[model samples]
Structure formats: structure tokens, C-alpha cells
Target chain A: MSTAIRDDYLEKLIESWKKEASPVHSVSYLDQLREDALDRIESLRLPTIRDEEWRFTDISSLRSMPFPRASAAPLPGLDKQAGTFLDETACRLVFVDGQYMSGLSSLADDGSITVCSLSELIGTRASIAERYFGQLADFQENVFVALNTALMHDGVCIVIPAGVSVKVPVHILYVTSRKDVAVYPRCLLIAEPGANVTVVEEYVTLYEGASLTNAVTEMYIRDSACVNHIRVQRESSQAFHIANGSVLVAQSAHYDSVSLALGARISRFDQKIILAGGNAECEVDGLALIAGRQLADTHTFIDHANPHCRSRQLHKCIVDESAHGVFSGKIMVRPHAQQTDARQLNRNLLLSDKARMDTKPQLEIFADDVKCAHGATVGQLDNESLFYLRSRGLTEVAARNLLTYAFGGEVINRVIVPSLKQRLEEYILARTRIG
Target chain B: MINANSKVLLEVRDLHATVGGAEILKGVNLTVRSGEIHAIMGLNGSGKSTFAKVLAGHPSYEVTQGTVLFDGQDLSVLAPEERAQAGLFLAFQYPVEIPGVANDQFLRLAYNTVQGHRGKEELDPLEFDDFVREKMKLLKMNPDFLDRSVNEGFSGGEKKRNEILQMALLEPRLALLDETDSGLDIDALRIVANGVNQLSSKDNAMILVTHYQRLLDYIVPDYVHVMEAGRIIRTSGKELALALETHGYDWIHANDQATGAQP
Candidate 1:
């Protein structure tokens, strides 16, 4: 819709990217869908800062390089690190370089849920995939999702039957070990009527290398169903990560998500939630801790299409050492969507003089009887608070680190998985810990 | 219980300080000996609180002309934390709120730091919990306060009690109680005054900065000095506080006018 994305440089880059051969696949069931995505990719060009949606995020550096696909390889030193596995998880799915590693994964079938790779799931669950796959996440509006759909390898799929509730969370760990390569990660989750489940999707790196990760995730919750999604991306500083998440909530269904971005040279996460049925609800929260020339951007859009929908969101960022953080959250209440309650808040802490934060809260309300509120703030540490800590015998560095750590603790505490929460706490501490 | 080897803990010589290009504490002098408590009574904006903050090395206040020595060492050479580690404490008039940092953790760190500086053993979490709880009893604070964020959502009296609780834990050589009696009910005042009285000993001293003479009834000071216009206009025993309470401050201005001095 914007002319900025159609510039000559990006158009040439898009043409070159399209010329590259598609990823090899054996799943012939979705050949036509993949073909349709590839054709759509040809018409869409890369976005630049001049575009209204990407004014603060500059991705011209990505157009300068050609990141080819990589084949399956043994993960380097993953046996020692376990690739950040979480405790008390019902099932664990491991993907290395966009290829599913069955040897490193564990599956348990209790007859109430189904979790498997897309390839192996094609036989008996073909109907489930055919019905929900590529349904909610439209590729026409998003270039990253279209690219991911056109070149994705194997993906993880989880289906919860009706009238059943899953207690433990499902863990999906994506590991990046190859440098100078592009990896496409996909996830499809479907909660049937009255089903309930929790999922943790984490992207980590086994080595520090330059890479690109394009991720697309879709979640569908039917009537009275509930789902909790926790997505963590702590990739290497040399990596560029772009992810898109699309969610749909039915009548009386609930969806909650927590997205954390800790490490990435440049990262952008776009999340869209649609309350399609009456009385649907969602709680979306996020945190981004970055430093040393890193840039992290988050864009969220919540649509209240039906009456009696509620959306609550809080996004925070701790920027240090010349790092830049950006957040733009938009909530839309349609003309007929009465009784809609929406709230958004964005708070940022800039630790260094050069650290920067760009925050904006957009509310588009067409219904006169709806309720909506939004606020944003950016500031440094309070001098009085710092002196108060110092007066009590704490060093200045220790005081600063403690305050910075506490700023992020509010979002990290929302994680339900114990081991994962502990890991995240440790991660934040290590980042803010004084030498 | 006085530490006889180093009796005189603080000596402020003609202290002149300015904040935001305006002088607050001008030409003030005082000496505090171990085992002695002094009360500085003054009206609002008379620089009593500024004097305490200056001694505690607050970054905002600048000592334009002054010499402060603590135990024969120049106080200007130490940073705020270093001064704190050197056994100097200042209870803030308005306790700062530090959200998300638990009171127990902050108290233990402050205790262990000063203890380490004094060559004492550091306590673990369990040990610190027991030790802090015993000290919290001095102020009659609830055990739930230990888990709350420091001064966050605390009532005015609770904040004042937390300050005194910290004083009991640190056991500083010289404690500057800056308006600690403000914003406290009579019951909270008695509890805070009793806690301060218990924390004081012959080995340590205190300088109570207050506006009213009501607090003097609970903690009887050895000396009381009336401050006016950034300087101590009169120095006398505790009777002077009662005299000021009864006679009011009008006679001081009359005396200042008679002596040809600024009121």
C-alpha cells in the first residue's frame, strides 16, 4: 500500500530473493498453498523506514546480504547445553537449522492431545492441518509471513481435543548453529472447542554467528477454549530475527501471551490478535532487554470485531549502551463492537545517555460506547532512588543493576513455567549483573 | 559504653554550603562527641536538614567553605557509600521508595556491608532474616513489611519506622535523625522514639533535627541548639527547647534585632 517499499533497491532485492530456488520439501499435500505463497512473494517488496508501519525500524542492512538456506547438521555442543530445555514440560520439540531433530526430541501421548512434526503429522492429522494451516495468518498483507510460508521446512503442530485440559506446557526449542544462512521457523496450534493448553516457543543460539531467522506462528482457539503462548527469542547478537504471530479467539475464549526479546542485532516482532466472537478476552505482555548497538522493535495490533471483548497489554524495554528500542501498539474497536474494553501501556528505561526509545500507542475507536486508554513513558533511573540505595551502603553500579533488573522483573514474573521462568530470571540478572 | 579511644566523632568547622546557587547552611559549627546526643531545633527552611544532608555527602549540596572531620579523618574524601561504610547514617525526612527491591534484601545488604567494613562476619539469608526480625521488633514493625518493596505503598508512619529499623541494624557511630518525628501519630511517635532510644548507647551518638519540642519529651537530648537563618542563634541545654515551646520564637527575633543581627 506504500510506495516506500517499492523503491528500486528493495525491488531488485526482492527479485533476486525470488530467483533463489524454493526449499526442498516432501509434503506434497500443501504444494498449491506453498505455490500460491511463492507467487505472492513475487508481487510484494521489502519495506523501508519511509513506510508508515516501519518508520522506526530500518532493515536496509538486510538487503545488502544474500542469506542462502542450510541443510540439516548435528548441533554443535548441544548435548552439553541441552539447548535451554525446560523442566515439567509434557513434550519437547527440537529444531536445528529449521530441520526437526527427532533424536533430540521427546514425545508422550496421553490420548488427549497431539504434538508432532508437520511431516509425520501429514498422515492421520492431514484434515486438521488442511483446515487450520494458513487460515488465520494471511500472507497477502505481510511480506515476512509470505516468505516464511514459501520457504519453510518442517514445523511443529499441537492439537488439543475438546473437553480436555492440558496442565503442563509444550516446549519448542529452535537452535541456530549455522552462520550466514537463512532459516524459516513455523508453528501451528489449534485448540478445539472447550480445549485448553499452554505453549512455550523459544529461539536460541548454540553459537554466535551472523544469521537470519524468519518465523511465523498461528494460534486458533475455538469457543470456550483457552491458550497461553510464551515466546522467547534470545538469539545471537549477530543475528537478525523477524517474526509474525496471528491469533484468533472465539466466543468466550481466552488467549494470553508473553514475548521476550533479549539478544539480536536487529529484531522485529509483529503480533496481531482478533477477538472474533463475543466476550473473547486477551492479555498480551512483552519485554525487551538490549544493549550494545542492538535494536529491538515490537508492533502489536488488537482488533475487537465483536461485542464484550477485552484486551490488556503492557510492553517494557530496558535499553543500555547505545541500544535502540521501539514499540507501537494499536487497538481497534469496530463501529459495531460495543462494550469493548482495551488498555495499553508502554514504559521504557534508558540506562545510558546514548540509549534511545521510541514508543507510541495508537487507539482507533469507532464505537461511541467503547472504553479505551493508552499511555507511554521513557525515562532514566531516578536519582533519588539511586542515592537512597547508595546511602544504605550499596555501590552505585550495584544500585543501578538492581533497579534495571527490577524494571524487567514485572513481565518475566508472568511466565508460568517454573524452570523457564527461573532461567529467564537468571538471564536478566546476568545481563544486569555487575562485574 | 563510649569508645574512649576516639571520643569526638564529628567536628564541623564554620560549615558554609549552597544548593542550586543559593546558600542553605551558612557559617555553622558543631562538635559531636561519642555517648552524647544533640538536638537541632529550627523552623522550616532554617537549614537543619541541609546540614545533615551535607554531612552525609549528598551530591546536590556543595560545601563552599567548610571543614568536616569524622574520627580525625576528612569527611570530604569519601563518597556517600564510603561515608555510610565509615559508620555515618542519615535518616531521610522523606524516605525514598525503591519499587521491586524487597526490604529484607536491602536491609541485609546494608547490614552486611557495614558489618564487613567493621570486620564482622556476614550473615546468610536465614541468619539475616532472624537478625533483622529481632531488630524490627525494636520498632514494632510487622513481619510482612520484610517482604514488601522498600517503602513502596507504605504509610507515612511505616516509612519512618523502616528508617529507624535500618538505624538499629547498621549501628552507626553517629546517626543524623532528620525530621524522623514528622508525620507520625503519638503512638507511632512513641514506638519510633523508643526504638531510637534503645538503639542509642554510650558508644554512639545522635543529632536529632526536629521542628517541635514534643519529641524531646520521649528522647531527652543532652544538648539543644536553636537554628535560625542557616546558623545556630543560641546553644543551651534541653531547657532551651522547653523555653522555646513556652515562650515561642518571637523573643529570638527581638533579641536578634537588639543585637543588630539578621532574623
Candidate 2:
């Protein structure tokens, strides 16, 4: 009944990591990956609030702050707020607190995509960074992804090449500079066979108090590849965001994702899509616009393992004021995944009345010639389509912000990225004119 | 021939309404002047679709006692979109469908929200696509239903000719219709009664709410009434809707509950 608490901030992070003097190239592989994340966080256990996947998300206000350990400083005027999706890019990976600035990154001038730094791909390609770092993230069953692989410094790797595609997209951005800081940022994308790419991950925050962002993204997508990922979290409302994305996809591959969680005071996003082969395709779309007292949690897993795979999930939430929205979507399939055509939809609107939405859509079909479906809906705002849009002269706050932007514009007009769907319809019409 | 100073619009009065708590319009009175059309009929719960969804501010019906007024203002303090931008219009017996919105952008946002409540100047989407292609050629509709969606997969006579092409592009001064020919078929109820008689004029006005008399034999109603258990016992003219379509509302619900009368 003892879970070792000999803490004084873990003895000042173990006497500042035994007076640091090694990392110039594998100090015993960073001391065996920080003693295997402190022996898997002192022998796995923490996940309390009655677990069921961290029931309604409670890390007791993130184990009461006190974060530190992310310092490389120099964030200075975030290069004029890193705009043109991080200025004239083809490849760009910035980071800032979770290390890797490499003088604000930029690579691909046609060497068929490699974009460095994960400590220069583990100090000069250590066997392709030991066959893909943390081999597709599990971190002994996530505790902020084992504290983001126990404070893994420097991220971004990206690969591409085999039958190349790469035309543009690749921007990575991270940010979060100090003030109660905690930034973990880790990303490793691979592609290969018949490769094609598009990735844009942007999470900001250089100031405006309180912070914590523990991110991890690992994607593979091989055979007949295609990947279009866009995660844009506009942090700092006194931040706290936890993001985890893992995708595998293989045969006849295609993996699509569009997640846009507007700011956070608390946010959780975990997306896992496996599919693993046979005509694989996964499309995930998400939009969140929570207001004051914000809390957004979106968890999705679509595994369908093999046989004629296909996965589509649409998530939309726009909870206002007393904001709180959580959507859990799962679609399994498996049994020799026959003709698996999975679909999951979660829709929520609830604009104030103490806004709240908790939608769960699950389908664990053991393929009987599968074609699974999962749906979740929590409503409000269709008082006959808000009196058919305020009898056509839209005023009740422009007909409830045009029917909550046409209910998250049916997954932001299924974004095929027209300048990120006109900057997510002008950031959801400036968050419905500040609610 | 409506024109005693050509206005009055909609009056209502003894109104009374209700839905799940039962009492469906029991004391109904009515007016609607300017270039009339009137109709009403009755039968199935004879509240004529709860007085056209309590004159279109349907919050699951519950008017519970009079006062509607209209053109001379006071519509129970507005709200069904400010009684549809103050000119009032109802249409639906079913209508809804709104999938992802576009039937010509919901009739150009209900004709620029009734031309921005009559102060005018709105049009744009290419002059609202040539003012909705001349009101979708007066309800013959189909310009590929202005790129689908609203009234979603249409048909029930293309959602009653897309509700008379949104009552001829929101030119309302009181429209109402309701069971707009419930599931039409006599050639889509004579093309949704000639697009509600070419958008009635003199200053617009109509009510209609049928139960049959074949949609007042194609919009020929200068007054019909009828209703039952919930007022309007029986008013006349348009040959009392061809005598309740050949004597039917069970002899006027047995002559108004056998003269303990209340029609």
C-alpha cells in the first residue's frame, strides 16, 4: 500500500538530473528513456476519478498545477504571431517550450521530405530513431501520455518519400511560453509507400497566464498513402489542454482528420484510429466552441482491424456559457472485419440554459457482414429552426447564430480545406459574436 | 373584394389554443381583410391545425385566450421571428426539413428577412438569383429546387410547392395556409392553388387551413369557416365549402351538439 512519495519535486527533479552533462548524443539513450518513465510512473496506478477512461475527465485540476521543466526560453514576439500558417512554408516545425526551435524551423527544399529535430532524429538517425520513437505511443496506458513520455524534449520528425507527394501543408507550430508552464509536444509522422501529405498542427499561448499542454501525435499511414491532418487548438483561456492522436492505417491508406478546439481552460482530445490494412480509410472531423468555464473532451477510437475498412466520424459541439461538452465515440468491428463500413456521429448544440452536452456513441460490432452505425445527439435551437430564422430577419442573436452556424456547419462544410474552410468560417463567426 | 380602407389584415379575438394539454382553439373568432381568401373548414380535432399553429408562433401551442390583431400591431408580443418580420406567414402542415439549409439559401434568407422588415434594400445573391427566378416561375418550382436541402428530400408535391415558393418570396401581410392541402395530388393541388392565387393582392391576406372541399376547389374562398368542437361552428359563402364537401362533418357535428349549440 505504498506508492512512493519521496517528493520534493522528485528531489528537485533528481538533483537537476544528476547535474546534467550528457545529451550530446545518447547518454545511455537518455538514461534508458528516463528510467522508462520513472518505472512507468512508479508502477502504473494513477487514474482515479473512478476511471472509466477518466470518468468525465478529472485529473483533479491537473494534480494541482506546479509544472515547470520546459525551458529553452527565447520565444520573443512569436515571429510576429506566426501567421501565414507560420510564414512561407513547405515544412516548418517550431515548438518553443517543449524545445525544438531550431531557429524557428523550415526544411523541405525538395529533398523529398525529412524535416529534422527530435534531437536531430535522436542524434543523427540512430537507426531511424530506434525504429520510430516510442513506437506508436501508449506510454503504459496514458497518464497525460505518461507525462508525455516523461518530459520528452524536442519533437517533430515527419518522413514522406516513397512515391512522394508532399505538395505544401506541413506546418507544426506549438508555442506556450512560460507562466505556470507545462508543455510536452511530441509528433512523429511516417507515410512511405505511395506517400502523400498534409499536416498542420497549431496550438498557441505565449502568455495570458496559466498553462499546461501535453500533446502527442504519432501517425503512420503507409501502403497507398494519403494523410491530411489539421489540429488547431487556439489555446490560453488560462490553458490546460491534453491532446493525443495515434493513427496507423496501412493498406490502400488514407487518413483524414480535422480537429479545431477553440481555446481552453480545460480540454481533452484523444483520437485513435487503427484500421491497419485492407482498403483502409479513416475520416475524422471535429469542431468545438465552448464558452466561459470551458471544458471540452472528445474521445474517439475506430479500430475496425482489416477487411474492407472504412471509418467516418463527425463531431460537432457548440455549448455556450456554462460550457461543458464531452463526446465519446467508439466503433470497433474486428471479427475478420468483413466489409466494415463504420460511421459515428456526435452532435451537440445546447446554447446556454446552463450549457452541457455529454454524448456517447459506441458500436462494437463483431462483423456479421458489418456496416456499423453510431449516433449521439443533444439538442436545443430548433424551435422550428429558430422560428425559421427569426422569420427571416435574423435577430434573436442572428437566429441563434444562424442555427449555431448551421449546426457546426455540418462539420464545417466537410472542410476540404479552402483556407481551412475560410478560417473555420471566420472562427465560427467570431465565436458567434462572443456569444 | 376586400377593401374597407383596404387593411385590417388579421384580427382573431376569442382565440384560445392548446395542444398536449388538449383544448385546441375553443373560442376562435377571425378577421383577415385586405384582398381576402379565408377558408378554415375542420374535422380531425377541428382546430384547423390549432389555428394555423396559433398563428405561427408555435412553441408547441398554448395561446389560451384571445388577442392577435396584426397589421394594427399586437400579436401577443411577437416572436415567431417577430411574427415573421411583422408581416406574418405560416405555410407548414409539414414543411420543416431544413437539412443543411439551402433551398436557394432558404429563399434568400426569407427574401432578405422580408426586405429587412420593409425598410427595403437587400437582394444580392445575384439579386437573389433574379428574385428567385421570378418566384420559381410562380411555384412550378424546380430550378433543381434551388440546389436542394430545405424541405430536404422534398416531394409531397415537392413540399407543397416549397410552401408556395415561400409564399411568393415572403410577400406576407398574413399568409397562414397550414394543412396546405395535406399531401397534395390533384396535380399538386392545382399547382399549390395557383401559387396561392398568384400571391393574393390588394395588400396580401389568406388563411386557407383545409380538411378538403378539395382545397376550396383551388383557392376559391372568400369565406368558408365550418370548424367544430373548437368554435367557428359554421359560417358560410363559398357554399360552405360545398356543404362540407357534400354534407360530412357529420351534419355539423349533429347540428352543434343538438342545439345546445356552440358552433
Candidate 3:
């Protein structure tokens, strides 16, 4: 745990901020908040391997480099590169190199839904953005969130009215196309009471050079509302992606999230949820497929502050070649949160002898009348199944790849959207060499 | 069945296989010609399953000293998939549950691979579905099994039937069924035996490996071989199964010892 990496990066970041000055927004309070976030980042510094939350994942490599703020670049034929999930989405907000691309985005003019860039929202509906932004994700404890808060200039802001159920999903595509640069993308989502909506945030990079994407999303689910949040990270093989998200669920609210990681040289995602209301339900599903010198880590924390709440989490990883994966999930039941039920499971499959996985599923129950259980397992593919497939005329490689695809399909099958599921299946098949 | 013009489909000479450095098949020798069903019956731990697995090229078993010839080709040089493409099929006692792979897809892959090896035309999904449905009727398998994962969450009987369904689709020249009747009920045994009977023909051969004499009754064998300590010590006609059923395998062991044979 060396401070040299932090001091070096801190000086570079401060120098860049001095050159660019500060971002201008309609609300002066947000500018002050950004300054406060910068101060918070300075105080918190970057977490090293000594930190318990980052014990398995090392960030010294990220801190050692100088990733200046990425400038907007023209992405030719960007419209042709849109993914399969874009067609079925009701609305899509596209961003390239951390800058919003209005020409490529399809934002319908509808009064019931508010989907716009955070910068525009700051100028237009400053009051609404002022209420929800910077509320859920705590910048003081998380350095990535603090960095995103301090440096983010544009992102998506989604606000759904009360008692309305949106049938189609809304997607936000964060595409990067530069080398040796960093981008900060921030998202703020607010669902009023009884509102139901599904929001997907996808991160993909087109370039083959090393880049860093530090993103933070804050979601607020009001009383009795339902919100499904999905984060798909399919960045370039040379990219480094670090995302931090938080959800604040209100009384009887249901918040479900699925975080899928398929590419990156080094990727880490941390999501925290606070069950502040009684009878709140949260389901979190995650899947990471890493191979060939890649390291992907997922950390989640669910805090049950009220009684009669339930939380379920299932995270899986498929590691191959010299790649590594880490999963650390914790469920905390407060002293007064009686009758709380929580279950957590983490499963990993190592496809090669050189591949490795570290899993820690923890449960801290303080209440007496709570039911909590957690389990983790790491193993290779079943020998019987491999032999079975081989005996049926499949080559050894084909058998292994088929089993790997099957292992990953468990999480993809949970996606209710047929088109997204099909697209994800194709991605897995191509990556795992199933087809 | 005993004609001299019949061609030998499988020949095993002094087959000795080991798993984890422990020999399971100790000098097992067997020969089978086309158009014959030979039953290998023995007690538990007598290497019945090991022989079947070894013949099927299971990676766990190392053939320390053996030679298995399938249709005049040396089986030692081929991989498991190659052995399968060469028309050697084994019906496992416990079918594997491969989740996320539909039964129809698995069956089609196997069928196409075999067809490719034989230079036959492969069918598309819809055409194969129709063809497989007709074959499934022989085993009385429901059509829903095609959509489900291969053997995943299937009952014991259903798994056995699925194995038989695969056997029907493959149409191998030599088939080895390892304890296929162990976990099945009487009704399942009857249906499985009926399917085997329908699939048997003059152009193919079968080796039924089982512990019970009951399975032999349903699918009558031309010859019954008693395996003791991994070696076929006694070979007799089909009536030998009836004798073992009534007097048990211990009497044979006692007679072998009385005759001063190797214990």
C-alpha cells in the first residue's frame, strides 16, 4: 500500500482541473458539491490492497498511469455499430468518448418520461436533478464515486412519474473511442411512488488501446416502486472499467439489478443498496466472463435497516487461461431488522489450470428472528459431463466450451427481455466458443 | 447365430485397464461377431462397468496391457469422439445431466457427426425433429423431452430411455450397455428391452453388461459370460443366466476353487 501512486495521480488531476476550470451548471449548489467531491477524493485518496473492500483487486496499476480527461472525438460509422438491444428499447441515449451524441440517440418527446443528458437536465430542470443527484452514492467512502462526481461533465438523468408503468426499457449506451485517456460518466435515476421502469446502462469501447472508464450511478426507488437496473460492460480488451453504483429502496419497493461483465483488461464494479423501508425486496444477479490475462471483480453490500425485508444475490464467474475473478458479497441485517431473510450464493468455474477465482460470501445477522445463509464454490467443469459429451461425438474442446456456455447461461436466462437475452447468449457463445 | 460366415465386430485380447493406478480389468478377453448379443454378468465390483468404460475410451481408465479391435481397427489410437465416429457406442449406467443444452440439439449433433463420418446426408433441425420423434416413439418418450436439457431433472427411467434413444439415433455397429437395468423398474426394463430388441439387427452387435439375471430374461442373450476378478472365467449358453439367478454366483466361485482354478 504505497501512497506514491496516489500522490502522483492527485497532482496530475489537480493540474488538469486547473487548466479546465470547473464545469458550469445552472445550479450553483452542484458546483459547490463538485468542489466538495474533489476535496473528498483528496482526503479519501485511492484505496490500496490493504483496504478490506479491495483486498483481492489491486488498483495501483490504475493509479500509476496518467489518464488525462478524454476530449470528444468523431466516431465514424458509430450508428452502424449499435448493438442488438438498441432496436427494442423505447428510448436510447448514446454517448461516445464521454460526450453525448444527440445525432445517434433516439429520445422520443414524451411527457411521461424524462430522459436527457445530465448537463441538459442541470440547465433545464435543475430542481429535479438537484434533489436526486449526489444523494445515494457516498463519495466520502468510495474514491471512484468521488472521482466520477468531481470530473463527470455529462451522463444520463432519468425520472419516472408516480403510478406509471413503462412497458419498454430505456437504454443508455456509454461508448468510448480513445487511447490513454479517462472518462467519467455519471447517472442519476429516480422512480416515484408506484412507478415501474427498467433502465439499462451499457459500456462498450471501440478502440484497442488502454483507456479508463470511471462511472457512478445513483438510483432512488420511492415507496412501492419497482426498478430493474442492468449494467452490461463489454469494453475493449485493453480497457480498464471501474463502476460504482448505489440504490436507495423505499418502503415496499422492489429493486433488481444484474451486472454482467464480458470484457476488459481490468474491471471492477461495486454496488451498494440500502433497504430503508419495511418489506423492501432486492434481487441482485451478476455474471463475469474473463479470460486471457483479464481480472474482473464484483463487490456488493446489502444493508437491511428495516424489518421484514428480503434480499437475494447470485453471482457467477467463468475464468479461463491466465485470467482471474473475485467476488465479495456481504449482507448486513441491522439489530432492529427482525424477520429479515437473506440468501447469497457465489459460484465460479476455472476453465484452465492457470485460471483462478476468489469468492467470499458473507452474512452478518444481528437480529434474532432472521434467516440468513451464504455459500460459495469454485471448481472445474464436471468430468462426467465432459466425458458424456465427448462420448456422444463432440470433440474435447467442443465439450469443454459447451459446458462453459451452459455455466454462463444460468445468469443470462434470468433476463426477462427476450431480445437482450438472445443478444447476451450470442455474446457468450462467441466468447466461450460454443458455436 | 453360430454360422462361420459371420464377421467378428469386436475383439478384446487380455484387456487390462486401471483407474488411479489400481487395476480394474485384469486380463478380460471377449469376442463378439455381428448379429450377436453377449451378456456379461457379475457381482458388484467385478469390473463389469470398467470393461464397458474402457471399451468406450473413458479417460479415467488407462489400458495398461490390452488391445481392443473394433471392426478390424485398433481402438487404442483413437480418441473417445473418434471411437464414437467409428460406430462404437456405450450406454452409460448413469446418464449425465448437461444443463442448458437441449436434448434435441445434443441428439442432432451426435446424429450429424455420425452421418458425416459415414458420408451420409445430415438433416436440418425440423427434419431431424421429425426423424427423432419417430425414433422416440419406439421408447415411448414424450415429445417434451426434446426441448428439455439433456437428462437434466429427468427421472431414472427417463434417463435410461434417453440413453436408448441416443442408441437408436446413432445406429452403431457395436453397442456396449453398462448396467442399463440397475436403477430401472420392471416396467421400464420391459420398455427398454423392447427398444433394444427393435434396434438389434444382423448388421450390428451388442454387449450387455449387467449384474442381474433379470435383464437377460427380457433381452435374451446368445451367450452369457461370468466375470470374476475382471476375467471371464466361465462362458455358457443363455441357460447359464438362469442357473446363476437360482444358485447365485457364489456356487460358481466355489466350483472354480474346487477345480483348483485361480481364486
**DockQ score, prediction 1:** 0.67
Report the C-alpha displacement of residue A205, candidate 2, in angstroms. 21
Local error of candidate 2 at B239, Å?
7.3
Give the alpha carbon lDDT tens digit for every residue of A305-335 in model 1: 9999999999999999999999999999999
Candidate 1 scores a C-alpha RMSD against the true structure in Å of: 3.1
Error at B30, model 3, angstroms: 0.6
| Residue A150, model 2, lDDT | 64
Q: In model 3, what are the clashing residue pairs, if there are any?
A: none
Report residue A376 deviation for candidate 2 (angstroms).
28
Report the TM-score of candidate 2, chain A only. Answer: 0.33
DockQ values for all predictions?
0.67, 0.21, 0.73
User: For residues A59-95, could you state the per-residue lDDT of candidate 3 as single tens digits?
Assistant: 7887666688787787768878646346677688888
The CAPRI-style docking tier of model 2 reads: incorrect
Residue pairs with clashing backbones, model 2: A392-B113, B233-B263
* iRMS values for every prediction: 1.1, 8.1, 0.9
Candidate 1 chain B, which ten residues in sequence have the lowest lDDT sum? B1-10
List the pairs of residues colliding in candidate 1.
none
lDDT tens digits, residue span B1-263, model 1: 33446489899999999999999988998988998889999889999999999998898999999899998899888888888999999999999988767789889988987888889999999999999999888888999999998999999999999999999998898999999999999999999999999988888899999999999999999889988889987888899899889878777777678999764
